[model samples]
Target: MKNKYYLLICLLLSSILGGCDARWDQVLRVKKVQPIEKIDLQGIGAEQMLPVQFPGKSALLIASKNKGVLLLDSNGDHLVSAPGRVETLAIQSLSQGSLLVAAYDELSAEVKLYKLKGGIDRKPVLQYLGGRDEISPQSALCFYQNNDRTHLFTIGDDGLGHEYLVSPGPSTWELVEIRPLYFGEQVNACAVAPFNEKLLFSQPPIGIISMNADAEKDEERKLLMQADQLGEDFGGLWIDHSGNYLWLTADARLQGYELKNLQEGSDQTIYIDSNYYPASVGVIGKNIVVLDEEVDSLLYFEYEPLNPPEHPDLQLVDEFIPRIPASAQTQPVSSAGDAADDPAIWVNRLHPEQSLILGTDKKYGLNIYGLSGQLVQQFAVGRVNNVDISEIQHPTYSAIAAASNRSTPGIDLFAIEKSGKVEYLGLQKLNMKDPYGLCLYYMDSRLSVWVSDKEGELHQLDIHLGQDARNWQLKHVSRLPVEGQVEGCVVDAQNGQLFYGEEDRGIWKLDLHRYSAGMGKPKLVAEVNTKSLVADVEGLALYLHEDSGYLVASSQGNNSYALFSRSGTEFIGNFRVDMNRELGIDASSETDGLAVTGANLGTEFPMGLLVVQDGRNRMPSGRQNFKLVSWQKIENILNLSSATAN
Candidate 1:
């Protein structure tokens, strides 16, 4: 009985530990660190402090009860001021030496915007641009940029967050729109790190929040802090200029983390050995300033230079185009944890409006959906990951669909009947360990199915059509070894050519006849480069028109698709499938398998449809599902309406 009670106690403790961040160790990298230097505020008590950037200089902006807005240099020497006691301040640098400043005052319940212009010998001028009355004092205020849009993010003590679109033209500045973040309790601290532009917030003793500050990308928040150790006083957030380090202040502890290596469980933790209840931390050129909560004076410590600044993932906004909205989405998979893997679109020739989409539930079975994205049928067969379909001139079947069945360790075939319904045919066994991605190709009287395995093996088989349905069988035709794991495969049946992704490597081209012959090897048409593809390239599909088309690959690392010309495999462009708020459909992320056809399927999909498996189904968050996009929407956005012309 004693042992049983002890086991229960151990289980309870483990469960609590699992919800918190990793264990904290003694101060690593920086040792014997404490605030040795003190900044004599000279009887000025500061309520808040932040490091602000000017045209050619930077200074610490402090809010004092006596002084309105005090700008102090590294030596704590006062530079300038915007009079009238301010509680919070948020500023972002604009083009042409104009600083868009946002200030809020608690006494008068006023929030104002000013255009700050500074010169070497002149007092920084704050040109009043706009003002608004607030109901209550906001907890924190910050600015963030997403693409060309700028927004102001603020959190209140009510645990509610407000995001407002801030438009600062040459002459005017005002909040144009508002987007709300309804976070329940304990969310107070918020800071936008400069280098990565990641929005970091702390929920006191709860956890640390890290998410994309950009309104354009996935705003999914991630926790990266050891909450149990952070105490309830963990709130203040600061980012050093020209660095990627995120400085955090909690009660008697102060630590900075290089977020890039933090996820890798690296010990880039910079800490202070001594205790200090800091109200705010100001990171300057060569010193760190912390406002002492108990005293009128400020404390300063000499710190080592922070991590150098690198480009942010938000840089994709400039490098890659914005995601077009998804037109429709299918019901989520019944099973969870990466169940919905790939999708194959079946265009009904008899009834063009009655097209169907066959998607794989790698954890359960297969799901069939109509053009409206409603599940028409579901088959609890086995784990089928990736799928494709091809028109076949068989004696019995009208069209054939095939998927890589990890359960069978081979290919699972299906028949697309004229009623726009899918029927399970049979599974062809493969000797490979884990058969992963599969695509079908049919020309003349020959129908071929290609399957790739995780252990770097590629195989091809020919299906022999029998008059009876049960007599259908597969004959192994070719087997070839690859360099690395491959998942996405596509075949251009019109040209008798094959294209496949080598996962981490790049996309390759091979002649269909050279599968087993080893006479001539596949040519690396496109190497996995930063400009075109980011690795573990998951999906590949061809949008063929006449004799030329485009090869689309799921650049899963960045949640975008890279397009290449089919004739020469030249990198055309990259695009993302963004969210459609009106239709209530979320964007695609970590896309596993996608299928596209350039054939118009009636008025609903007049330019055909592009179906992609949305690995992270969010917006109205649910299980994983497939997002259907209009092919014409992609072509127009990429300006390929004429580019795909023969």
Candidate 2:
């Protein structure tokens, strides 16, 4: 009996160790790793495959170069087959339990679409839809669903992509509004982000590019990953509904990227055979399936959730930074103390040719400049920390600008003329200590100014322009808590929301116009301690559109900017403004203030502009100055659009 018990214990110990070894191999970058499952396709001669998920079941659509398009259930049982030797296969879900399949013919190099008919009980039938003769003969096609309309995307050998909106006709599918996208690379695979509606594509020799689905020009697309990090050859691309991207390389490796921030997260070797070459990849349920044409087999990998790296994967590490051409540079303003802190751009409605930039020389006062960066006017109104402009309905002046007076516990006011000139209107004393950050907002016929102290106390002061326009009435309306040193603040007047940044903490959102004498409780927008945001969140700016908006916060500790959705709790991504070689200006770091707007300021800022305070402008030595960036450049890098929230 003792010998039998010893034998049982040995068997159990061996089983436990073997299980650990299997899991351990999966985590490492080893050459010989066993897949969870594999399906033999040697006899089928499958060239490419795509995963399809319907209301009740999951299946695989295989494109056989020799045969036709074959539909197989998850169990590998053949269900349906459509005539036409295919080189590439793509499947997409349609409204009302319908399905769409796109196939590229191997011999003719023609692209055609078919609608899946029938239910789970019977073999589905493929109804002939439509064909595009204008498409490049040998190309790969993908599908994207935006709102309720479906779009077909194809990348040709010439590196140009064509997008067609699918419109269902009486008996077939119609393609309309063919939009061409010049990716400038021989892209073979493409995927659409389920969360942000961004198009992700791959360029052979390992490059990934992202663009908004509605972008009409090539300049709007940004290369997310270059060929330096990835191997020389790139394969299939897939993005799941959870915003996780899977990419296959010719070297038989699978890479996982986070779609929310466009950061690389996990990597694994697909097959052990040296000759194994991955032709395509797809996500079926929780498994990643890779098609190896060399071995004529499908290798499966279980999806693994990886923790994001300590350092953000997506960062500005290359020298190809988009330069916002500086038409001219302003002559440094001489001050007794440090000057040139923040700037606000105001467009001249009467003379659109004379738009001006209002910059605050901290030690002196406010200095106004023309679009060419030439000094137009300067006011000697004490030391001011921040400045902002707003249109005020006053009898004398139609618009006014305000700045936080750093030398005293007050805020200075100025009248702005349409021709870019400013008149000193004296300072208004506030009931706060050491006012630091300031911004002006108008809503519902009420003009208000928000001022924050160095200790994180935020006070909202209502401004009532006097009849004579020389003096202004200030009413202390509300006070909000920020805990640490708080500085930057901006208001979304359309949403009645207020956002402020705590230097050591993160950002806070509160009810702005509804705040009744500090009665409203502020909600934490993001927390630095959570690692999503770096400590000392410095500047906060809002880029509002017709349907959606973005809240950009300066993550000072990492020298990157964190972008969050204005309507949702999603952290879109983070970006850094690196050195612009073309303009000979260094990157912005330790940013104290930033401002963004969607309104066109001038020809230089036709789309909009982003002005960032460069805390350390290291050309020859460090000097503080505001760097103007075209908002369109930011929109391209981040792949943001009005439909991004959808």
**Model 2 misplacement above 4 A:** 1-339, 394-396, 517-519, 529-532, 642-646
Q: Give candidate 1's TM-score.
A: 0.66
Report the number of the highest-lDDT candidate: 1
- Superposed by TM-score, candidate 2 places the C-alpha of residue 284 at a distance from the truth, in angstroms, of 50
Q: For each predicted model, how many residue pairs clash, with residues at least 3 apart or on different chains?
A: 1, 2
Q: Please report the candidate that would top TM-score against the real structure.
A: 1
lDDT of 1: 0.74
Superposed on all Cα atoms, model 1 deviates from the true structure by an RMSD in Å of: 11.2
What are the runs in model 1 whose C-alpha is more than 4 Å off? Answer: 1-144, 148-188, 201-235, 238-278, 281-318, 394-397, 514-518, 642-646
lDDT string for model 1 (396-479, tens) is: 556888888888787787897776767888877878789888888886468888888888888888887677655678888888
